[model samples]
Target: MSKSVPHAPTSFRELEAPQRKAFFAAWLGYLLDGFDFILITLVLTEIANDFGLSKTRAATLVSAAFVSRWLGGLVLGAIGDRFGRKPAMILSIFAFSIGSALCGFAWGYWSLFAFRAIVGLGMAGEYGSSTTYVMESWPVHMRNRATGFLLSAFPIGTVIAALAYGVIVPNLGWRCLFYIGLVPIALTLYLRRSLPEAEEWQADVGNRRNVSTSSMLFASSRRLPNAVLAIGLATALVLIFSQHTAGYGWLLAAAAIAGFIVFAVQVAGRLVPVMLAVMATVFCAFLYSWPIQSLLPTYLKSELGYSAVQVSTALTWAGLGYAVGSCVAGIAGDALGTRRAYVVGLFLSLLFVFPAFALPAGNVVLLWALLFAMQFTSQGISGLLPKYIADHFPTRLRAAGLGFTYNVGALGGAMAPLAGTTIAGRVGNLGTALMILAGTLTVVVAAIIGFDLPARIGRAFKADDEKASSAMTERNTTRAM
Candidate 1:
């Protein structure tokens, strides 16, 4: 038996038709994921008015969706690992598409929540399915660029939602917005006909069949450090829960203690570089960026007295910035390294994001510029994930590993809307809450950099293609015998 690793395509045209179709399918699916979710944000006020709910209650809908994404990612990620990305992707699109349509008929808060949860579950798999499909299909050298293009969909869909809502909601109504989500069903059909599974994935499937879903990172003594790291992280989570449950303002205390605890655990645990890589991307990319996107519309409409159309305009501009920034970050990450690029972009975000929210919101140009820079910097840092995911995990467990990183991060993101609204409910201003959150997140990211976390993660990289090929060859030989 023999194994082979192919060279990455030098240009987009070099990719085969199925590979090209898979790329487009993944991008469109990713875009629609943003579209469906952001549509909720755009219509939050109308829904609140119809249902007689407070801002906090409306925000809870967003939280519910995020919480469910954890389960969706875990389940679908395993499916992707065990079966194929195309199937997982197809199912996920169906779930979200149906869920979005169901939302149009919802009469009350609970009903909407249930439907949104369905959408969340479906949306959750995109990170594992489409991302893994395209990333694995492309050559490793283009990893970050492909991810940038894919991730750029987040902002593009958001922008479309913003603009579409501004145009459609006034003319047709909020329910009409939900109907628009049904459009992604077209993508599912396209993917079914045209998409191709990654060769790398096909090669490794046999070897990955018996892999554990629960605590896969802890299956060996050599992997015990990852176990400790997981435990330490869990402990940190418990501490955060206790502090938050006790009261606000204890987060700093909890975070300080949790840091020390993680350090102690690392000393005992020898945490895997890949795990740290995941944490760095999670903290830097998702934690700060998501809340701004989810809750900013509320702030603009309620606090700043902007019309719905105006808010949509601002968001559309920002989303465009994020989309472009994703492309630029892809290049920068390769040059400066992902972590360093993240540190720089994050710092840039700290400069404008707060002002984008805190400043007087009447001037469209000023708001657009600030928001563009804010989203560009914040979302740009996210460019780190593609490269990291491609580099860190083996082919056998790639989807699960990617899903775990993304969904676990979404766990924190799920809390963002709730936290923002709760803080706004307390202090009477969303701006204050956003500033507090953004400032705190910036500090944490800076501190993480100061601790030299990126260097540790960087040292841990190994290319998986050859090993994956060998695994496939070994499996094929055994099966034939």
Candidate 2:
């Protein structure tokens, strides 16, 4: 007879030493994945200079990476569901690490693009497996908080990338940046040695060993909902992209529409209105923040005549803002409730984005301050969305649902840089682009407050909080006895 594996941990503190270690290991690996993905963004101008390519072509390289990530999410999510999360994580880490190393050696745009695609493929598996592993291991009450903690790494990864580029790229060149990117391969090896198979995944593997992969995610009854979620996510992402690309004005409008649509749907379903409201808030804040994020480094380089290292330093500070925001959001989600925290953070984001856009480009200090405020709010609120999605699904289909939804959003995000660059290139100005993005975010804010703001958050958070509190109380009482 199969022996019973230990039950899932009921609280963050109750997680055994081994389990906590594994979680941190997985978290770091995911963080590195984010770093590898965004590294190219920081060094885009350098790449263009070296390769003699246009900005659009350089942007395509970034887009290709996201496309690869989308494909990886689709394919690897299924694999994670069938094979097991641990193995998938190991393979993904290895794939991305090797792919990043190859990027350093690329002789042409096409070669670098191919390597980026490979990295995306590797990254595809990283989130689904890791998120699933963390979600499944934690107690029900702690699920949202735990997921929030894990996701907080995303901004941290970006900060690391910014720092690396800031310190290394000016002196060593952009190719060396990719060479440094290979350090995460050692991380992959460490994960392989340290992380045990997720107990939940092992059980899932044993029970469903005979089931076909497609049937697992796309069963006849579940197909409709899955398709709906995917479509919704894709639509939201597209709107997000349009905003990021066109201008703050466009982004604000898109965010408003998205928030309104999300609110309307949740209201119709009698779900939490706050959930949609918070999402809208985040979309708006992020729209205001994100354009400035990637654009600032380029702006400093081109308009202000700053060196690559100076640009990278500015980028690092922005990334640090994101990291701090994410960490704060994670902690706040557990304490203030996910919806409240998201709303507050998003409001702050909106507040920052508007004034920052109003400042002249020559005012670098003011611009950085605005960007930091935007990122802190946007990234902080973003940390909660994945956890919210994960909390909504059951274990069997968790990875697929999360992967599909996220990638759809990513697709939208991927489009933003292209749109932004094209518009700016055509207009011969970045001001218009910033305006459009900010506008989109404003719309997103309106959508949040008017639409479903109470029901969905209530449903998702209440169940999770209740379970977590009960578990912790019982554990404490047991110790007392």
Candidate 3:
């Protein structure tokens, strides 16, 4: 006879040793991601000055890293799906850690840009692989909270970077700050020692092994059109940067985006609507966030005339808010559902942007408080994402779907720095530029999640759950026979 299923753990205290270990390992990976990625933001002004670059040029360096993130997500996410989460996580950590170290040795702007791109590849890969590993390890009932706690590691890393900047950059210079990014490499050892391949993924792989190669080939072919459309959009994005001054460039980018959306509707697949919703939601969310995350330090230092120490202090406050917000988001997500939590946080973020960006630049205390509030609302929504996105796909597609939707959406973030700087130059006010971009995008995200997405995604998730339950029953019955 088939054995009875065991009771699922309901709390952190209830999790077995391996489950808790997996969570911490993934959390550490996210922490290192935040540190290495945001380190450039903390020292953006110093890097620009050192390289004798203009605002636009400095922004390009940030964009360079972002442009490759989607590719990393696609490649490494596939690796996670096809091979195993443990190996994928190990590879991602080593890649970013080594890439971060190489930044310190860069000779000039292009060299630094290239190095950061390498960092981006690893950083993007880490999220999907690590998140899938952790989420699969935990009980389904606790996923929202567990994901929240895992993502909180990112902002904590931001806080650490801020503190490191204050301590290291002034004395040892910006290069030393980057050198510190290499520290996460040691985390790879902990990960390898502590974690195994996710059991869920292994089971899924075993079930799929007997599937025909022809069926796999057919599925791959079906996705080719979406891939082609994605590639086209990416190219148009590059043109936006490469041809920013050209009037037709804007028209071309707009046309490309419109074309992609239209194609999604015409595609006529069950996943089309889901992907469209996810793509739109993630794209807009990044648009809202990246202006602040990428450019706020420059705004504080260059525009407001704040010192590096003051900027670090401001970031610390924001980081703390993000951390608290993440935990609260997890709890709220569990109680309210991911959709409501996301919509509420996004709506609040839209309201908070005006005060955060438009208030008097002279009052440092007010600025800090507003920033904390803004990050709390805006970035806290991030805590909902790992659970929100992962629930949509099965174990087989989990890594690839998470990686694609999230990282491809990062294209919006990839554009934000350059776009924000360009607008700031045209508008003659950094705060106004930021407000316009952030406020507009927040509305887009809130509306998509609140109106267009929830019912459809909920139905899809429920169907998947019922299907899995049925399959389990059938398997157990066959074994008993």
Which candidate has the highest TM-score of all?
3
> Per-model C-alpha lDDT, please?
0.71, 0.64, 0.77
What tens digits encode model 1's per-residue C-alpha lDDT throughout 36-112? Answer: 97778888889999999977778777765665664576567767877788888998888888888899889998789
Q: TM-score for all predictions?
A: 0.80, 0.74, 0.85
Superposed model 1: Cα runs more than 4 Å off = 1-17, 206-208, 211-285, 446-481
The root-mean-square deviation over C-alpha atoms between each candidate and the true structure, in angstroms, is: 7.1, 7.8, 4.8
Model 1 poorest ten-residue lDDT run: 263-272
Poorly placed runs, candidate 3 (over 4 Å)? 1-7, 206-270, 454-481
How far is 409's C-alpha from truth in model 3 (Å)? Answer: 0.6
Which of 2 and 3 is the better model by lDDT? 3
- Is candidate 1 or 2 superior in TM-score? 1
lDDT of 3: 0.77
Clash numbers, per candidate: 1, 41, 0
Q: For model 3, how does the per-residue alpha-carbon lDDT over 46-103 read when each residue is reduced to its tens digit?
A: 8889999887787877776676676677667767877778888888889888888999
Q: What is the lDDT of candidate 2?
A: 0.64
Candidate 2 lDDT over residue span 228-291, tens digit each? 7545544444344323335555655465345444423422222224334333343344445455
